[model samples]
Each structure stands twice: as C-alpha cells, then as structure tokens.
Target: MPNPIRDVAPTVADAVANERERQESTLGMIASENHVSEAVLAAQGTALTNKYAEGYPGARYYGGCEFVDEVERLAVERATDLWGADHVNVQPHSGTQANMGVYFAALEPGETILSLDLTHGGHLSHGHHVNFSGQLYDVTQYEVDPETGYIDYDELAALAHDVEPELIVSGSSAYPREFDWERVGEIADEVGAHQLADIAHITGLVAAGVHSSPVDHATFVTGSTHKTIRAGRGGIIMCDAEYADDVDSAVFPGSQGGPLMHNVAGKAVGFTEATTPAFEAYAEQSVANATVLADVLRDRGLSLVSGGTDKHLVLVDLRDSHPDLTGDDAEAALAAVDIVVNKNTVPGETRSPFVTSGIRIGTPALTTRGFGADELETVAHHIADVLDDPDDEDVRNRVREDVQRLCETHPIYD
Candidate 1:
C-alpha cells in the first residue's frame, strides 16, 4: 500500500522512515534514551498540540481547554501516584527546563547551588556555567571520591556546609550507583538548603522501586518524562503540597507558557503503562541486563566505574585497558556495526569532553525490546570483541551479523 506521506511530503516522510529503520536496526545503548511505545508516539502527534492550554487544569488563559485539562489532570494524578508527590507539574519542555522551574521556585538570583560535577556524572542544569542555573546562581560543584568512584556523602556534607547553598541538587547523568537520598537530604537540612533531586535519567527505575526515591526526602524532584519511563518527550516536576503554587507559577508564567497538551496525554498514557507489573519487571530486567553486561565486559578486561552497576547503565573507563582507544573511537567503531553507545567522561578525566576516555552503555532501549541478561551478555561480548579490535573488518562483520540477528528477533515495533 502506498502511503499518503510518500505522496504529499516525500522528504519528511523519508526522514521519518529512515529514523524508524535506524532504530529498528541499531542497538540503542544511550543511557538517557529509550524507545517509546507506538501508542505514545501516536498520542504526541494528535490534535491536542494545536490547543493553547497556557495555565493549569481548569485555570487557563485561553478558552476551550476542557479536554486538555482532563489530560493534564490525569497526567498529574498518574505522576503523583507513581512518584508519590503532593503536586506534579507535567509541563516543562525537557529535563533541563524542569530543573530551571525548581530553581525559579526555590532560589533567588545569586543564591548558592551546590551540586555534583558534570564530569563526575552531574547534569548541566545542576550548575554548568553555560546553563541558566549557573548564570543565575552561585554554583558550587562536588565530585566523587577519587579512589572509590562513588559520591562521598561526608565530603558532600562538608562542601554543603562550606558553601551554605540555598539549594543543593542531587542527581547525575552518568553515575552508575544509587545515591543515598536520605544522607543528601540530611546535608540539605543541616545547611538550610532546599534539595532538588533530578532523577532525569532514572525516572522509571525510581518509580518502579528499583532505585531509592527522594520524594519524602527532597524538597523537590525533577525528571524527564521520556528516558526510562517511556513517556512522550517532556519533563515533570514533583513537589510537596506547600511549594505547589510556587512550583506551578515558576513553570508557567515564570519560564514557559502554553503547555504541550499532546505530550501531557502521552505522559498520562506512559504513566498508566508504568503502573503495571510488566513495567516493574522491565525496570528490574534493565538493571539485571546491565549487571550481566558489566560482568562480561570486566571478564574481557575492561574497567568499569565503581567496578559494577546498580542501575540500567555501565560507564566503561577505557583508559586503563584500551589506552590507545578513546571513547570516541570505540563509539564510532560500535556505531559502524549498529551497536550505539555514547562517549562519556569518567571521573577525573584528562581528555576533552568531546573526546572522552569512557563509553556509557545502557540497557533501557534494548530491555524495552525484551533483551534479557543472556542476550545482553552476548551483546557485551560482541562489544568487547569490537573494542578489542576495531580495525579488524572480520570482527566488525561478525558483530554486525550478531547485532542484526538480535534486532530481528526482538523487533522494536512489531
């Protein structure tokens, strides 16, 4: 059957088709990415996008927002249920914006913000000088222990007291261990700081109870709707009932207007899916697959940050075992054979961020495709082989065949 998109907008249609093919063919191992359901994809493409719901549910600047209000209300309810927050704002455009909303809600300009270092697994919004949070706030960055490759809560507490930050951010993009949220909360409390835990990369893991949640501990929690949650593209902010109004105003009139209601519907749908037992199993399996992959990689002589994983991703420090191979080199080598991973900086990295010494491999997307520990171990062995000899065409060809076989068996949108 000939599609109308091919007839009317061939160029756009071709790009979309190519992306679908690319996703279907490749092993998507990017830690902060996942393949969302077709239902979610359809919901985000609906006519709700045309609506202008500039305010919260039932309180809109524009008229005829009833349906969007319903969607937004449902999204909030589901997010609240999953995350156990007194209030949930499912309207930030992305994770960074969610962090911005928290900042606007809690801190005045020039106030201090203590957070993890970017190279030490912290996110950009946690006070990278290039970001709005840093420009507006006095940013103090912390790092993991140089020897252990883990956050030292005592050290963090020391820094928090020294800085006396107005807000202390606890979260990471590439950290492979679970944070002691309670300890962080204690530091924030001792220093009279509002704790904002941005679980942007592990929203699903936290929601599924695989990771310790910060709802009761932190003053605010921010997350992306997509990553591990499989929600349509957006961000959400969760807060206690006391800060609800401040958070709401900060998100709407303060930073953005006209909520993406279609994405809200998608978030609602994905939240529904996440509430099911199946999603819990998927979340657990993601971590298990990562654990297996880490073991296999370690057996092949690769160095993992923290020596293992407690989540759905592993950060491979290629500096020790593969001294000649930069993360960029390994990323390109794997991408050429359809195993997609991102170049990432390890703790105490010496190279440029663009050309990092480590590669971050994740299991969420592949786990979404039903790749279990055995399958993931096979994938890891293939990864080790590629890293062992990126210059060998025969090795590349063999791994390509195995990757294609796995993709064929576990289809993305069948």
Candidate 2:
C-alpha cells in the first residue's frame, strides 16, 4: 500500500520512518528515553501548535483559545489524578524548565540550595557549576557514599543543618536505589526548606504503584512526560494549591512565554494512557525486566552499583569486569552492535565524565514492547559479550542481527 501521507508529506514521513527503523534495529537502553505512541505523535503534530495560549484556562492573554484552554485543563486534571498532586502546571517545555519554575517560585537568586552532585548520579540541574541552578543560586552539593553507592542520609541532614539551604532537591539521572522521600521531607521540615523531587525517571512506576510517590511528601514534584511514562516530550510541575499561582507565574511570566498547545494535548493523552490497567502492567514488567537483567549481569560477574536496582535502570560499574574499558568505549562498542546505551558516572568514579567507567541501562521501552525477563537475560549476555570484545566487527554484526529479530518479534507500534 502506498501511503498518501508519506507521499504528500515526504519529510515528515521520512523522519518517522527513520525513527521506526532506529528503534527496530537497536536495543534502546537509555534510562531517560522511551517510545511514545503514534496517537501521541499525531497530537504533537496537530494544528494546535499555531494557537497562542499565554495564560491558564479562563485567564488568557489572547482570544480564540477556548479549545486550547480545554486541552490544557484536561492535561492538568489528568496529571493531578495520576500523581495525586493538589495543583498542576503543564506549561513547562522540559524537565529542566519545570525544575526552574519550582526554583523561581520557592527560592530567590543567590539563595543557598542543597542538591546531589552530578558526578555521583545526580542531574546537572541539581547543581552542576555551569548550570543555571548553580550559577544563579549558591549550590552546595552532597554525594553518595563512595563505598556503599547510596545516599548518606545522615550526612545530607548534617549538611542541611550546617548550611541552612532554602531548598533541598532530591532527584537523580542515574541513581539506582529507591529514594527515601520520608527522610527528605523530614529533613526539609527541620531545616524549613522546600523539598522538590524530580522523579522524571520514576513517574510511571510511581503512578502504577510499583514505586512510592513523593508528591504527598515533597513541597513540589516535577517529571518529564517521556521515560517510563511512555508519554510525548515535555515537562510537568505539581504542588499544593497554595503555591499554584506562584508556580504558574514562575513558569509563564517568570521564565517562558506562550505554551505549546500541541504538547499540552499530547500530555493529556499520555496522562490518560498512564492511568490505564495496561500501563500498570507495563510498569510492573519494566521493573521485573530490570531485575532479571541485573541478575544476569551479576551472574556474569559484572558489578552493578548499589548491588542492583529498585527501579527501571541499572548502573553498571565496569571497573572490575572490564578494567581497560572506559564508559565511552563501552557505549561505542555496544552501539556498534546495535545495543544502544549511554555511559554514566557511578558514585566515586575514578575517571572523567566524558570517559567515565560506568554505563546506565534500563528496560521500560523493551518491556513496553513485550520483552520479558528471558529476553532481557539474553540482552545482558549480548551486551557483556560486546563489551568483552570491542574490536570484533563480526560479533557486532551478529548482535545487530539478533536485535532486529527480537524487535521484530515484539514490534513497538503493534
């Protein structure tokens, strides 16, 4: 069948086809990325992007925004219901923007903020010196224990008390263990600091009840619509009703201008999808696949940070298993074999960020595509093999072929 859309809209069709091929050919192991549904993609490509809805529902800076207002309203409602948030702001363009809104709402410029260090599995927005969060605010970073590969809760409390930061951020890009939200909330309470949990990676798990939700404990929560949620690209911020206006204003007049209505519509759809029974099962399987992969890696004598994961991603410390292999080498070698994964910095990494000694792998996308524990075990072994021999072109070609067959057996869109 010759598709009319592909014939007429050549560029758009080519891009989508390329993406489909990319997904089919390679094993997607990135913890922070996912395959959104075609419906979500359709919404994101709609005419809704042309509308200029600068303000919230019933309060707009432009007319002809009634439909967009409804879309944004539906998105807000779904987000609140999914995460049990009191107030929702669905305007932020990215997770970083969502975090920025929280920062602008709760803390002033130059105020001290305590967060995890980037080198220790924390996100850049948490407090890297070059990021706006650190450049604008006095950021004091805390790190996980070098020996335990976990957060030192007592040390975090001591540092909070000593420095008296106005805000305490709890989140990570690579940390593998379940966060202690109760302890974070208590510490924030004691320090009179606002606590924000950036659960961008874990939102779907929390929503599906596979992991704990921090919305009830933290002053605010922010997450990306993608990742484990299988949503389209965008960010969301949630908090209590009292801080709603401040957060909204911070996102709009304080930082950005007009909101993307198409993205808002996609968010609405994604939120609805996340609340279903099928999504819950997918979330559960995602965690299960991660556990199986971790076990396979351990059986093969690979050292995973924190021993194993309680979430979708596993942090592999390659120092003991592949002593000569840097993270960059591992990522390249795996990518050559169609096993796509990103290099990450484990806690107390002895190497630099660009060439660190760890790799972050996850199972959400594959689990969504119907790969189970056995499939993941096979993937783990293939990954180990690829890393064990980076220079073998024939091995890479064989792994690529295997990935295509596996992906065909469990196609994403089907």
Candidate 3:
C-alpha cells in the first residue's frame, strides 16, 4: 500500500515510517509505553477528530454533539464497568490533567498535599517541585525504607499527622512492590484526608484482577489509558457520585476545553477489547514475564529494588553490582543493541535524575508482542551480558543478532 502522508508531506511521512520501523525492530522495555491494537489506531485516525464535544453526554454546549456524545458515553461506561466506579470521566488529555481535575475539585489552592517523593518511585505530578501540583499545593513527601526499598508506613503515618494535609496521593511510577492500599486508607481516615490513587501504570493489571484495587479505599482514582491498558493516548478520572459533578466541571472548564473525541473513540474500542478473556490472560502473562526477567537479572548478580517486582516492572539498582556504571550508560548500551529501556532513579538515589543509578524495565509491550517466560529469560541474559561489559563491541554485536532474531520471531502489527 502506498503511504497517504507521503503524497502530502514527505518529511512527516519519513519520520512516521522511521518511528514505526523502530518500534517493529526494537524491544520496547520502557515501563510507561505499550503498543495499541490496530482497531485503536484506526479509531484515533477517524473523522471524529474534527468534532468538538465540550461537555458530558446528553448535555453539551455545542451543536452536532450527538455522535461525539455517544463516543464519550461509551468510553465512560466501559471505564466505569472496568474499574467499578460510581462515576467516570474520560475527558482529560493525559494522566496529569486527570489528576489536576481531582485537585481542582477537592482542594483550594495552597492547601496541603501529601504524596510520595519523585526519586522514591513517585511521579512528577504527585507533587514534585517542578510540577503544578507542587507549585500550587503545600507538598510534603514520604519515602520508601532505605534498607528494604519498601514504603515505611510508620513514618508515613507520622508525617500525615504532622502535615495535616487535605489530600493524600497514593500510587507510584517506579516502586516494584504492591502498595498496602488499605493501610494507606486507614491513615487517610485518621487524618481526615481524601485519597487520590494514581494507577497510571497498573490500570490493566488492576482491571484484570491481577493486582489489588484502590477503588474501594480511595476517594478518587486516576489512570492513563495508554500504558498497560493498551488504549489510545488519554486519561481517566473516577470518583463517587457525590464528587461526580465537581470532577466533571473541573475536567471540562477548569482543566481543558473540548474533549478529544477521536481519542475517546479509541479508548472506547480499547476498553471493549480489554473486557475479553484474552486481554485478562495477556495481563497475567505480563506480570509473569516481569517476574522471570527479574529472576534472570538477579541470578546474574544484579540488585532489584524491593528485592523483586510484584507488578509489571522491575527497578534495577546498579550501584551494588556495577559500582562504576550509571543508568545512562546502561540505557545507551542496550539501545545500541535494539533493546529500549529507560534510566530511572531508585530509592535513596545519590545521582541526579538525568543520570541515575538505576534502570526500570517493563514487560507490557514485549508481552503484547507475544513474548513468554522462555523468551524473557533469553532477553534478560542478553541485557545482563551488555551491562556486564558495555565497552565490548563483540558482546554488543552478539546481543544485537539475538534481539533481531527475537523481533523477527514475534512480529507486531502483522
């Protein structure tokens, strides 16, 4: 098939073609990314992109919103069913915007927000100094135990009492273990604070019942549609009926203008796909693959945060094994071999965020491409080999061959 974009814009068509080729050739181990199905890709490219749906279904500020309203309604309904929420908003452009909706609805500006620290497996939107959450709120951070690489509930409780925050955020971007959501809810109750659980990375796991949910414990839940969910790029917010009006208003007028109807249609298609038993099996395999990857890395003498993972990603702290190596060097070495992974900061990190001592590898995209335990084990060894001697061109060449073979064996997107 001739490329349509090639006829109109050759430069953009070249970049798009190159990017698609990159995804097809490389192993995407980045935890925050996954490849959506062709159905979702088609939905996002539809003519619905031309519409402007500014309000919720059945009530819109613009004309000719009936069809776009149906798209948004399907997205909201499927999300509500998947997560079992009293209300769902599928309007926010991204996860950060979804979180902003909750904050705008629940707290006044300059009010307190207690959350996890960024370097300690927490997200920037979780009140880091550089994000809007930190700029507008009195943010206090809690950390994982330096020795065990786990959340210190005792310290968190003490901090909650000391700060008297109006809102408490749960969920993380990098921590390897499952959170004790019930205990965090207890602390929030004791301190009279509302809990916002950001399950951006684990939405698919949570939906598949592979991971415990925060829906019952948190006052609000926010997640990205693109990550583990394999959906179009967007965000979702869920809350009780009482907060539904506030969340809707916050997302619409407070945070953004018209909703992206095309993305919403894509989300609807992905959510429908997620309801199938096959997707549940995929979610389970993703966790199993991560576990196998962690085991292989550990057997090769690398240190994993929390000792291992209970979710879809593993954070490797390289300071103990490769004393001189940095995450940047490892990422580059692996990228050279067509293995894509991101440098990440670990708990008690001494290096700057740009050049951290850790790397976070995930299994979602690989799992989607049909990689199983045996394949992951082989990939893990290749990773360890490169990291063990990144300067060796011979090692890089050998691993590059194996990676290419693997990509050929499990081709994506037909």
Candidate 4:
C-alpha cells in the first residue's frame, strides 16, 4: 500500500504516519468513529478532487464536469434508494452542513428550534452556544428523564407544545435507547414544526432495516457517512421530492461552494455495498454485540445509562462504580492499555462536560472487524478490570496483552 506521504510536506507526512500508527496499534471504540474500506479511501484520493463542479449535475456553473456529474448523480440516486428517500442531497460536506442546509431551506433566521440539550446527548450543531446553530437561531432545550436517562416523549411533547418551535431536531450523541420518531413526528405536527432526524450515528442501522426509519415521518433527515455507514467522510440530506429544488439550492449556494465529487463517488460505492445481504447481517451483529457488551459491563456492577442499549452504543456511568475516577481519567487510563473510548456526560452529570461522569463505548467498528458477542464479552471484562485498578501498571499491562490478542483475531480491513 502506498503511503499518503512522500509527495507531501514532511510535517504532513509525519501526521499521516502518526494517524496510520494510531489506527494500526489501538482499538477504536469511539461511538462516532470507524475504519473506512480501502475502496472508499481510494475513491477519496481520486482525480475528481482536482475539479470544482460548482453546481448540480447537468446545470453546472462551470464546464468539464461530465465525469463528475455522473458520479454525483449516481450518488444522489443510490442515496435516495438506500434510504427510501423521495429526494437526496449528496452535496453537504458534513452532517453539520446538512443540518445547516435544512435550517436555511426551511426556517427563517432566529426562528425557535427545539432540540435536546447538549450535555444530555444532543450534538453541537443541534444548538450548543458556541455553534452557529445557537447564535443564529432561538433555541429551546429539552432533557432526558432524570430517572430513566431517556427522552421522555410525554415531557418532550409538552415542551414542544409550550414552545411551538419552528423546527424540532431529534437524535443523540450518547443516548442508548431507540427513538420514538412517530410520537416525535406527531408532536412536531401538533406544533406545526419541522422534524429533522439527525441520524448520523445510526444511518447504517436504518439503511439495513435494523433500526427505525425516520424518512417516513421527518421533514428532513441527515447523517454522516463515516460512522456506522463504513464509508468515507461526507454527509447526506434526505427529504421529500417536492423539496428537492430547495434543498439542492440550499446545499450548493447557501452552504457549501463546490461539491466533493470524489467523496460522492465513494458514498455511491458505500450505498451499493450497504444493499448487500452481508451488510444486513453485519448490521444485525453490530446490535447483538452491543447488547452483549452492555450486559457484560452491567453484570460487572458498572451502571449503564438507560439501563442498557438497543443499538451499537452504550453509556457507562462511572461515578457510582468508581467514585474517584473522573471520565477524563478513566479515558486516559483505558487508552494507555489500547482500549479507546470517549468521555461523555450522563443524564445528570455532576461534573462539567470536559470532565464528564461517564464514558461512551460502541461495538460497530469492532463488529465490522468480525468480532462477535464472545469477543465483546471478553473485551468488556478487560475494560472493567482496567477501570477497577486504573493505577496498577501490571493490571493495565495484562489488559493490554488481552486487547492485542483479541484485536489480532478480528483485524479490520484485512
């Protein structure tokens, strides 16, 4: 394999080398991250990146887009078919931009948008203060049930009715349970609000029919290509065909300048691959592995948010299990032993987001590498052991050896 270096600067080459080393050496357990296929990587590095197709297919502002147009058109068609979408916009550079396009197309500036609170699992683009979504729009926040650690639909509906928001954003970054989109849709309709499902993490599950589809109920749906989709980095927006022109214009001129045709082609490839029976089996296994992992952790006396999981991710509340170990400390300790995960705020986090009370782990990437319930159980055991003795070097060393052995059997993209 050729390195993404030599022709690049030494600093850039060193960064690439470090990234490759990190991926090769460590276990990637981060819920929002994954390893892309070689085919997708190759497509990303193709010559299409050299061209700037400023507009949509067949209506470009610039010429010499014949091949690029075909790639983008194929991406649009495949994405629409993949998600059963009436219309698809393959132009958004990331999930954040996809969301931006939706807002730009549907809502006026400073209109009220009801979204889950950031510390409680909502994304930054969903209306965190630092983000443009918060600065440009009037945001109303919602929270998970203090007892259940899940979005209480009854409470959410009452909030929606009270705020009468112009848009209601649904999705989560750390939530473990399945969403009730139908009820959410009903609440949105009652308030005359637009419902947008930011299913960035569960797009693969939805694609394989393993999770609930939001396209049927939501006015717009958005997702990242890299996460569960096992594709390259990009974003897609799905909506009804009647809004196709509005979405297309919003993406092309309102949000991003030029579409990445190479990424679009890779997305097309991913969409095609996601249609296979193997992909369905893989998606199903992803959920099963997560369920098994969650059970193992809970059995070890670790408190899990939402009690358990219905998808690939689990949120482990470390405060009750290890009172002294902050989420940041636990995350660093685990990384030293080759187990990777992110620190996340739980339902009622006592600490700030920077030093959260919980850690988020997911099995989709590992499951994609052929790991099943047995391996995940063992992995969970080692993780628990590491947490139980975070200061013991010998214990960490032993866990490191176990992790290496486990990862060897299920080499990603081998």
Candidate 5:
C-alpha cells in the first residue's frame, strides 16, 4: 500500500494517532468497551470489507463471495461452539439490530413487549420509548426491588400475567448480578410469551462459562460481538434450528443489505480465541477485578448499586455518600485524572439520565491490559480519591501521577 491517505490527509491521520495515544495512556473502564487484540484489528482492516455478501453462506445474492462465505461460516461455527446454540447469525450491524432481527422474525407491529426499565440497568434496544422498538410496539417495563436491589421475580411474573406480552426481555447493560434465566423462562411460559435475552455486556463471560447461558432458556438470544468478546464491531443472533431460516431471512431481506465481511472475519478470529483456556482466565479475572473495585470503593464510604457486584462492572450510586454530587460530576472529575468511566442512571433515580446519580465502571479493558485485583484496587483508590474531592487541584494532580504510572506499567498495544 502507498499510504496516500496519510500523505494527503495529514489532519485525519493526526486525529487517528491522537486516539491511539489516548487509548494507550488512559484507563478504559467503560462497561461496553474493550480493546481488541492486534490480530483482530488486522483481520478487520482487510480487503474483505470491499465485498458484498448479501446472504448466508453458499447462498449469496452477490458474486465473488467464496472467501467471505468461509469467514462467515467460521464465525457461525465458532459462535455455536461458544454458546451452544443451534443456529447463529453474524450479520447484524449492532446489538440493537440483532434484537430487531429477533423481533421481526417472531412478532408483529403493536404486539406487547415487557422488559427491564433503562434506569434499572436495561438497554435502549429493549424497548426504550425513543428507539424504534418502543415506537412500533406496546412496551411495558419491570423494575428492581428498591429494598434489595434485585429483580422481583414474583412481581415480574404477576406483571407478565397481567399484560400477557408477546415477548419478555431479560438482560441488563449495567446490572451487576447474574440473572436467573430459568426463572425468567418460567415466567415467559406462564404468560405465553417468547423469551429474548440480550447478553450484550456478558457475551464473553457467558461464552467462558462464568455467567449463565441464555441459549437454553430464551427463545432468542442476541448480543454484541464486541464488548467483552472483542470481536470487532458487530452483533450476533442465536436461536433454535426451527427459527434459523426465519431469523436469517429477517436479517438480510427484512432489515439490512450486504454484510460487513471484514467485521465477520474479526468475529471468526475472536471466537476461535474464545475456545482457548487463556480467554477463560481473562473472563474470570474480569469478574474478580470488578469485585475488588466494588469492595475498595465501598470501603472508601461510597455506595454501590445492589450493594456489590457479581459481574465485570460496578455501578456506584453517589446519592447516599455524596448527595450534592451527580454521576456527570464524578465522570468528568475522574476523566480529568485519566481514570475513564461513564455516568449512569441508578434505580429510582431522582435526577435526569443526562446527569444521573451513578457511575458505571468495568474491568474488561483493564484486565486485557494485564490488570489484576491489586492493580484494580489501586485504580479504585484513585477513583475514590478524585470523587472524594473533585474540586481539589492537589488531589487531582496526585491522582494524575498515579494514573500515568499505572498506564506506563501496563502499556496497551505497545
């Protein structure tokens, strides 16, 4: 390659270099984000992106897709081995699109959908009013128990019985506890509704057997191939063999056009990695790091949603400890110290989602950078130090030194 883009478009090249510097220097604690391996990056940057594979393997609407078919088939086969699903579709552009594929395959417009509320750790694709899911369907929502910070299965069952929804969604973007998929399946059965579990944040954990698999419980399981799995930027859908043709048709002719074969190649590479022992260790460490983070923050007098975490992320509700502080305040303050995290809405939030009352932190990226419990504990102290006194310049300066040292010690992609 001549690299004319860098020669002619120096400004864009500089921005790309800056972004690489930013990721290499700062701590990436976003729950929905992860750094892909260099191999995955290489696969995603290939010439496969130029192809137009508009249909499933061996049956494409476009020509010259033989290699792309191999990539797609490899992705689906590895995905089946990873999740134990009967069928897998690797073409959805994102997790939201994957959910749409399932909904289109099974439900008609105006059918009722019951899902967890967004403020309680649910995703926007799960029928948020602003998304197409909400606009086209009659959506009802469930909430976590205020007293115990857990899903009330009894309440959910009662509500499902009351509404008789066509589909019931179970999964959360920020939920720190493992879901009881069997119980959710039981509730769906009682209401005569289909079960769709969106495991966008826990795809790797589930693949590694650290979290429960919804493949056996839900009628349809959808997830992002990125996030914890580090499979470039795309989505996947898994279902029974009975719905395979319908799901595939809905994904191609019903919703999207030519597939992103470059991303599919990345998914194939990542899924192959998932079948290894090292990936299992990574998943286990991710959860352990989150546990340490929650404990360290709580010891510093901060309140954690659900009181603690059983997953790879923690939601810190600052309302009880720092009533004057909002999630936005904590996020911006931490970012200034090079400790990246996101503002999030807590259950029964009294503030707007924009400001929020909580910060959601995760360990996948940190773990990928070779972080362990001790390192994460130190990172937690830095976060607590900044949140404890967001206005103090000395505190921020001191935390900045510590963060830079840690980033140097565990330099990513170096």
Candidate 6:
C-alpha cells in the first residue's frame, strides 16, 4: 500500500525517505540511540496519534478515550512487569521531562540537588546551570576520582552531608561503568535525601537483567523507552504506590497536558518484546561487543575512561593518545567514513563541551543491526585507523568502503 503522507506531501515524504536511508547506510555508535522494530514504528504512526487522553486511564477529561486508556494501561503494566516497579507512569514526553516530574513532585523551589558533575560523565538535567533543574534548585556536583576515572563515594558522601540536599541523583550520560545503587541509596538515607535514579541510557539492559536495577534502591526511577529498550520515543517514571498520585499529577497537569497515546502503544509493544529470551541474549551480546570494542581500542593505544566498560558503551579519552586531536575532530573524521559517534566530555575534561577531549562509542544500535564481537572488533580497528590519521584521505576512503560493507551485511529494516 502507498503511504498516504507521500501521496499528499511529497517534500515531507522525501525527507522521511532520506532519513530512513541514512540510518540504513551508517553505523550508529552513539551511546543513547537504538533502532526499534517495525512493529514499534507502525505503532507510533497509528491513528492513536489523533486522540488526546488528557488524564490517566478511566479518569481522562476527554471523551472517546476508551481505546487510548487501554493502550496506556498496557504500557504501564508491561513497563511495571519489565522493571519490577510498584508504579509506572508512561506519560512523560522525554527523559528530561521524567526527571522534571520527579523534581516537581518531591521538592519545592530553591531546594538543594546533589548530582554528578556534567563534565565528569553526568547529564545536563542532573544539574547543569542552563537547565530548569539548575534554575529552580541549588545544585551541587560530585566528580569522579581523577586517577581512577570512577565516582569517589567518599567525596560524594562528604558532599551530601555538607550540602544537605533534598535530592541526590545517581546516573550518567557518558560514564562507562556500573553504579553501586545500594551504596548510593545508603548515602541518601544517611543524608536524609531522596534518591532519583535516572537509568535513561541503560533502560533495556536493566529490563533484561544484564545490569542491576535501581527500582528497589531508589525513591524514583526514570528512563527513556527508545534507548536500548527499542521502544517508541518517550520517557517513563517508576515509583512506589505511595508516590503514584504525585508522580502522575506531576506528569500530566503539572508538566504536560495530554499523553501521546500512540507512543504509549509503542512502549507497550516494546516492553513486551523486552520480556523475551531473545532480547536477553541481545542485551548480553551488546555488552560483549562493547567489551571487545574497548579491548581493541585500548590495544590500539587509546585511553578509555574507567579503563573499560561494564555496559554497552566505552568512552575514549583522546587527550593521552592524541593530545592535539579534539573530540569534535574525531567525531567529524568518523562521520566522514559513515561511522557515526558523538563527541563527549571525559571525566577530567580540559576543553569546552563543544570541543571535548573524548568520543563515546556504543554497541546497542550496531548490535540491533545484528553485529557481534567479530564485526565490532573490525569496526573498532577501522575507528582506530581513522583516529590515528584523521586527515589521511586514503585511510578515510578505505574505512568508508569497509563501513558500507558492514552496513550491508547487517541491514536494519527491510
């Protein structure tokens, strides 16, 4: 069947087709991205997008919400089962919004927030000066130990005691290791602070049991559905039943108006897919691929933050191996060869955020494309060669051909 949008709007259709082709042709190594199944794609494009479910299931302000209420209920139930949460809210627009929901529900304005520093493998929403969380709260930051490239729990505890924050956030955007959730929870309890664990980047791994979950250790848990989980694009909040009403209200009447029911349906489908044994195997392989890639890079003389990864990504700090090469330059060089990655700030970054000292490479998208250890090893070598001489046209051309071949070998959608 012909696409109705293509028949009506050729320009928009052309852009959509080009975007799909782009994804099919490139190696997506960005740490926070993954390709969802065609079922998820279709669900997000369904007629449910036209409906506005302004409230929770059976409590919506809008009429004709029977079907959408069922969709939202399934999303909530499947997510709760997948993550083992007491309550799940699948209404937030994005992971940032999900964090906002927690903040809005838990604290008043000008309260203190203790989180990891942005340049030290933390997220902007955690407490960056430009974000709303920063504007509304007194934000104090903790950093990784400079020598070990890992969070310094002693310093974090000390800072929490000194700051006496209302909330302590535990999560990262570029850190390449697992967090000690129980320890963090203990520190929060000692400091009399609420713990908000943002698992946005590793939602799928946590769901598949490849990574430890923070559901029991945290007062609230939030994640992005579309990362490793391969859900539709949106965020989800999980909390205990006691906080359920506050969280739901914060998500709906506080931050957003109506829920995107189509995306909720996609979440329901993706959460169900995550419960399968095949997905468990896939999550395991993704971490294995990342480990192989990390070893290959380290063997090639690249310095990895934390020395390696316990998850699906590895952060390459270019300051040691290539002092003159900025992360932006490395990102551009990889992009030239059709291997896409994002420039990121390392634990002890000395450069600006836009021109950082590191590049983050992930295995989730490539693994979703059916890549395993051997393929990831080859890709890692290609990446090393390009970073070794980013200005070399011959090297770029050779890697470009190999990347094309790899993409063709592990094609994504039909």
lDDT of 6 by residue, 124-210 (tens): 999899999999999999999999999988889999999999999999898899999999999999999989999999999999999
lDDT of candidates 1 onward, in order = 0.94, 0.90, 0.94, 0.89, 0.94, 0.94
lDDT tens digits, residues 1-414, model 2? 787679899899889789888987677889898888888988898999899999889999999999999899899888888999999999999899999999999998999999999878889888788789989999998998888888999999999999999999998889899999999999999999989999989989998999998988899999988888877888999998899999999998998999999999999998899889999999999999999999988888899998899999999999989899999999988888788899988877889889999999999888878899889988999987788788988888888888888978988776
Alpha-carbon deviation at 57 in model 1, angstroms: 0.7
- What's every prediction's RMSD, in angstroms? 0.9, 1.7, 0.7, 1.3, 1.0, 0.8
Alpha carbon lDDT of residue 94, candidate 4?
90
Q: What is the TM-score of each candidate against the true structure?
A: 0.99, 0.96, 0.99, 0.97, 0.99, 0.99
lDDT of 4 by residue, 192-305 (tens): 998999999999999999999999999999999888987788899999888888888899899889988888888988877888899899899999999999999999999998
Q: How close is candidate 5 to the true structure, as a TM-score?
A: 0.99
Clashing pairs in 4: none
Worst 10 residues of 2 by lDDT: 19-28
- Which is the better candidate, 4 or 5, if ranked by lDDT? 5
- Which ten-residue region of model 5 has the weakest summed lDDT? 1-10
Model 3's TM-score against the true structure: 0.99
lDDT of 5: 0.94
Candidate 6 residue spans exceeding 4 A from truth? none
**Model 1's TM-score against the true structure:** 0.99
- Candidate 3 C-alpha lDDT tens digits along 340-407: 99999988899998999999999999999999999999999999999999989999999999999999
Error of 6 at 18 (Å): 0.8
Q: What pairs collide in candidate 6?
A: none
Clashing pairs in 2: none
